[model samples]
Target: MKNTKVYASYRYPSQVISHAVWLYHRFTLSFKDIEELLAARGIIVSYETVRNWCLKFGN
Candidate 1:
């Protein structure tokens, strides 16, 4: 089976996005928390941007 989903050009790797989403759901943290945690790893993400990914293309 083939799946179809559109994505943004944030250039993040799938694993990173998955981890972000997992934390977002598992810990019940806000997008800002997720963004900051990822940022400390030198990912340079914004809360609004992360929220959009969560709403749209997060896995």
Candidate 2:
């Protein structure tokens, strides 16, 4: 198995974090927009959290 321990400390799953980062970069979407997109998918993440994720992982 791949060492996913890097993501172990986060509250949300790695897939969720990765997808949020992907959406922000791939489409140049705003944090609020990404929040709504995830919300539509039943992921209740805040825009602030999205912003933090982008800053931390959206290299």
Candidate 3:
């Protein structure tokens, strides 16, 4: 069986992080833009955190 990695230490769920990363790359949005988008959805995350997610997950 293939092992699925879990985001055990992350404060946010995998869906939130993946969605933020997808928004960053798919829409060519800035980290701050993604931050605001998430904030609008009631998910308060920092721009720096979004930037980090892009760096870590982006190609």
Candidate 4:
């Protein structure tokens, strides 16, 4: 229940959001770079969304 709330109201899965946040903090990549990385894997997320995710989920 508590865990679900962490990912509530998001279109993408928890795994995707967590991965994006991880990539952002775990490396020197920018939002666009992470966006492109996900895009390469057919994720199709934008940099702005990446930024939001980082803000919301990143430590």
Q: List the residue pairs that clash in candidate 2.
A: none
lDDT of each: 0.74, 0.90, 0.85, 0.91
Q: What C-alpha lDDT, on a 0 to 100 scale, does residue 47 get in candidate 2? A: 99
What is the TM-score of candidate 3? 0.85
Please provide, for model 2 over 1-59, each residue's C-alpha lDDT reduced to its tens digit, 9 standing for 90 to 100.
15568679989989899889899999978999999999999999999999998888778
Candidate 4 residues 1-59, lDDT tens each?
23867898999988898889999999999999999999999999999999999997777
TM-score per candidate = 0.72, 0.90, 0.85, 0.90
RMSD of 1: 3.5
For residues 1-59, what per-residue lDDT tens digits would candidate 3 score against the true structure?
Answer: 12215555779888888889899889978889999999999999999999987888678
Candidate with the larger lDDT of 2 and 3? 2
lDDT of 2 at 40: 96
Ranking by TM-score: 4, 2, 3, 1
Q: Which stretches of candidate 2 lie over 4 Å from their true place?
A: 1-3
Please list all clashing residue pairs in model 4, or write none if there are none: none
